[model samples]
Target: MIIAQQKPIKEIAAMIADCKKVLLAGCQGCVAVCLAGGDKETEILASALRIMRKLEGNPLEAVTYAATRQCDPEYIVPMDDLVKDVDAVISLACGVGVQYVAERYPDKWVVPALDTKFIGGSTVHGVWEEKCGLCGECILHRTGGICPIIRCSKSILNGPCGGSQYGKCEVSKDVDCAWQLIYDRMKALGRLDKMMEIQMPKDWSKSRDGGPRRAVREDVIIE
Candidate 1:
């Protein structure tokens, strides 16, 4: 899932300082799971902003709303009626969700409330760790299910680079060496022979080098 963190309240306030009325839009998706931009979070932010503005004698009117998913057009359509009179909208979703809301309401000013983190999963309450690089290619078949692209500091395909020591990364002792982890995993699985296969250089073109990418299902498309 896409991970994100909410922006500072001061920064958010500055973004819509000129507006008297604004909408705080939240997503009940990944951001919600991460506890950054959910229904509860949206209401909290709105209340905080209202209190702060009121104390300052500006008195902002912040309306809170949430969608099943801000990234989906269908889920964001309901916000149109609520946003019609607001001067700006603060989206509490990832980059995709913010853009979706902006694209759906072209005339309304749309602002992001969260900083999109990465493709990761929650390790514990309030802690998320990146596990994937989303490189548009998959090579877990050879690496014992460990991702070298994201886990390796240098993204080395054939590594335990010279920097590895005591199964830890040179970048930091707290970090595990990606290749070392792979070697150990493969060894335990009796697939150590697979580690000997020289990996070819990764194809960069399959990644974000060109521009935005799209995956279309022709069979599912509506004529």
Candidate 2:
């Protein structure tokens, strides 16, 4: 899932200070799971903004609203009425969600309340680790399910780099060598022979180098 972290209260408050009334919009998707932006978070942020404004003698009016997903046009269309009335919108979702809302509204002042992190999963109750780099190419088949592109410090496609020592990465002692993990996994699975095969250079055109990507299924489209 896409991970995100909330921006500081002071920063968020400063962004909407010019407006007398602002809308705090939250998303119930990825941000909700990360505890950055959700229904409860939106309400709490609205209250905090109100308190801050009140203490400053500005007394700003803030409203809280949540959508099933800010990334989807279907969910965002429902907020048209609420967004049209507010002076500005504080979107408590990922960067993608923020952009989606801005593109949908076009005229409304939309601001992000969270910094989009990366494609990762929760390792523990509060710990989230980066998993995929979204490099436009997936090579998990030969790597024993371990992603060297994301886990390695230097995204080496073949094997461990010279920086690998004692099964740890040269960048940090806490970091394990990605290729080492791949080797062990492959060895355990009796697939070590796969590693001998040389991998071709990644095709950069398929990635962000070309620009924004679009995936469309003709069968799913309704004329």
Candidate 3:
């Protein structure tokens, strides 16, 4: 899932310093799971902003709403009436959600309330770790399910590199060497021979280097 962290309150307040009214739009998608932007978070932000504005003698009318998903157009349709009277929209979702809201309401001011983190998952209650680089390619089959592209400090396709020591990364003592993990995993699975096969250079054009990317399922599309 896409992870995100909320921006500071002061910074968020500054974005609509002059507006008397604004909408706090939250998404119940990935941000909700990360505890950043969700139904409750939207209300909390709205209340905080209202209190700040009231204390400054510039009272604000902050409206809060949480969409099932801010990324889809169908989910955003419910917000039409709520946005019509608002001066700006503060999106409490990932970068994609922010853009979706902006695109849906072209004339309204749309701002992101969270910093989009990365494609990752939580290891504990509050700890999330990045596991994929989204290189637009999958190489897990060759690496025993460990992703060197992101887990490795250098993104070496075939390496423990010269920097690995005691199964730890050279960049940090706390970090484990990604290649070491790969080797161990392969050995345990009796697939060590897979590591001996040389991997070709990654085609980076499939990644961001090729600019914006899109995925389509022709069968799902309705004419």
The per-residue C-alpha lDDT of model 2 at residue 76 equals 88
Off by over 4 Å in 1: none
lDDT of 1 by residue, 151-212 (tens): 99998887988999999999999889989999999999999999888778888777787478
Model 1, C-alpha of 84: deviation from truth (Å): 0.5
The estimated TM-scores of all candidates read: 0.97, 0.96, 0.97
In candidate 2, where is summed lDDT lowest over 10 consecutive residues? 198-207
Tens-place lDDT digits, model 2, residues 1-223: 8999888999998898899999889999999998889998899999999999999999989988899999887898888888887999999989888999999988888999998999999999788989898878787888898898889999878769899999999999999999999999999999899888877888877777868888899999989
Model 1 worst lDDT window (10 residues): 204-213
> What lDDT is reached at residue 176 by model 1?
90
Q: Write the per-residue lDDT of candidate 3 for residues 141-223, one digit (tens) a residue.
A: 99999999999999888789999999999999988999999999999999998888876889999989999999999999999
Give the higher-TM-score candidate: 2 or 3.
3
Q: Give the per-residue Cα lDDT of candidate 2 at 47.
A: 96
